[model samples]
Target: MDRQFYIISYDIGDPKRLQRVHKFLKDYGKPVQKSVFECWLTERELESVVSWLADFIKRTEDRVRIYRLCRNCLQNVEFTGPVYFAEEPPEELIL
Candidate 1:
């Protein structure tokens, strides 16, 4: 399966809901900030992730965004200053 990159961000009105979302994202991606995550996922996984999160947010009060980045866009991403909070994937997985 091919995986595409996605930047997922959220703003939840309730503290409990925000925590829930945070925990969930941790299982699936790398957290770049308190409420932002960077994920590489297949189309099916992306849909599943969004569907799961939909259960936790209120339409009127919470906001969630998922930005799909093409290979070109991902390559063109720019960063500045210290990135202490940035998440790095493991260099190797040992089984």
Candidate 2:
């Protein structure tokens, strides 16, 4: 699938909230690293997911973000897929 991936970072105010968001992201993808989570969606779906996340955060007192994959795509950095979160083959995977 030819789609963009996102590395969302939420500056959640509290550890419990941080954990809450992390758990929520599990519905989307896995955590390839700490704080940073990976989730793949097309141009349109991405916006929906971001909006959902923002609204979710608004229900609480925390910070959220949806940094564009295009902006964060560096030359040499590998972090994608649901390796730590999926059993079947995920459409998006990076190593």
Candidate 3:
């Protein structure tokens, strides 16, 4: 495996707060699931991003889950460019 991306998920309490987090990660990562994001990061970058993710998650009232993956662990990763979410809700939930 050359480079790998991690799939991180968040179970948010409020639809509003969940959207906030989804936006944050989208600006920095890729949104795979509704509230789950996939990011391709180097080891150092991943670690730093995870730390930042933890801080972001802690700020939310929702339950957040992150999965940091190795090259061998990924099933399918569509390398979409960085995503930036809106302040308002998405027109449709990407489940």
Candidate with best TM-score: 1
> On a 0 to 100 scale, what is the lDDT of residue 47 in model 1?
86
Model 2 alpha-carbon drift over 4 Å, by segment: 58-61, 71-75, 78-95
- Compared with the true structure, what per-residue lDDT tens digits does model 2 show for residues 21-85? 88888776657677777666566767677777776675457777675555245435554773342
* Candidate 3 clashing pairs, residues 3+ apart or interchain: none
Candidate 3 is scored at a TM of 0.57
What are the RMSD figures for all models against the true structure?
Answer: 3.3, 6.9, 11.2
Q: TM per model?
A: 0.83, 0.59, 0.57
Model 2 lowest lDDT segment of ten:
81-90
The model with the greater TM-score, 1 or 2, is: 1
Per-residue CA lDDT of model 1 for 45-85, tens digit only, reads 88889999888789999999999888788667778975532
Off by over 4 Å in 3: 1-4, 58-60, 75-95
* Model 3 lDDT, full chain set: 0.62
**Which one wins by TM-score: 1 or 3?**
1
Best-matching candidate per lDDT: 1
